[model samples]
Target: MTIAWASFTPWLALSGGVLIGLSATLLWLGMGRIAGISGIAGSLFSLKAASGDRAWRWLFLIGLIAGAFIVHLLTGGLFEVRSGYPIWLLVGGALLVGIGTRMGSGCTSGHGVCGLARLSMRGLVATLTFMGTAFVTVFVIRHLLGFGGSA
Candidate 1:
């Protein structure tokens, strides 16, 4: 309900958004591929994927990890892992996300960024569903369940 004024970084957030958009656009333009991380990663090791396809997927995944590492190093550990949440909870959440992505036929990056950019109706519906679910979940956790604190 309230903003975390101390942690607010609008400029950084805007910059990050721009970078994501730029990278997605570039990937589309250059390779004629959608920058759907989940799809790319999910098919990376599949027998259906060609050897050349696997190489790009590996590079993309590696670039994601490397980018985060580079930022962490540059900021001297600006990002810190939050404690308090149990490992099982985190793992469960990840598994649920993976399942959800599979069930939905694509992840947020695929449906939201690429699909929406192409003016696809499916993308709009998927994005709305994703956002609506997220809002409800946060509301339940913070207000009804009294789990997460106002951050």
Candidate 2:
């Protein structure tokens, strides 16, 4: 198997991972809540949460969007990512993720990061399933279907 050496950015990826982990840790330490995007987004629709809970949830959600904006500003431009899929396909995939997040108890950041760190058995299973599924998906799309990009 050949490696995509030109596309590899291990340093950048590791730095991003560190930043995410640190933010999650700080959120947990300061607010006693998991920094799970799905939960934060879903909590916005809850009308009966306690005042403090609602406030922090909203803050977290806003912070998430704002953080990305700030990063774009610092970087002087938005990064361009080349995905071969059309907008409709991207939206469809996002909708499917919403459903999966609802069914699976949390999204990747929630289960794969925070939950796994806490040593939850469910988190272990979810992470393994997700990683395995992702590997199979790339293999099928690239090798079997032969639709992967040139780069």
Candidate 3:
């Protein structure tokens, strides 16, 4: 394998990581909530949740999407994540993720970030399980099934 030095950016990557960590920390510290996309999305329609909280969550989610759009516009080039799948399939997959997040009680951000940071045993188990499953899926797709359609 060959690495392109011009495209390699350790400092920028580190800065992005630091920004994400800081954002998660601030969210948790200020809101007393885990910075989990799944939970935040779910809370939008949660009648039991306070409307004021939901309003903030909605704005945050919108800003996340808007930020990505803005970056795509400002940057000349961005990662072209090609998925050789139909829009319907993508929508279906997203719905499945939503359901899974609800059933799991928390998504990766919640478990991987807040849970693990707090040294919760369940978080460790969940994170390991998620990682293991992801590894197995990739292996199966790339090697066993030879599904090189797209990533």
- Order of all candidates by lDDT, from best down to worst? 1, 2, 3
Which candidate number maximizes lDDT? 1
Please give, for residues 31-61, the per-residue lDDT of candidate 1 as tens digits.
9889998899888744688887898889989
TM-scores for all candidates: the values are 0.88, 0.82, 0.79
Q: Pick the candidate with the highest TM-score.
A: 1
Clashing pairs in 3: none
lDDT of 1 at 45: 40
CA lDDT, candidate 2, residue 4: 85
lDDT of each: 0.85, 0.82, 0.78
Cα lDDT of model 2 by residue, 1-151, tens digit? 7888988989989998999999899999987888788877776764666777787777777888899889888999746767676675568767977787878878788999999889989988998997898789778866787765542
Judge candidate 2 against the unseen true structure and give its global Cα lDDT, from 0 to 1: 0.82
Pairs that collide, model 1: none
Error of 1 at 127 (Å): 0.8
Candidate 3: residue 150 Cα off by (Å): 6.1
Candidate 3 per-residue lDDT, tens place, 57-91, comes to 98879988987788788985478778675675468
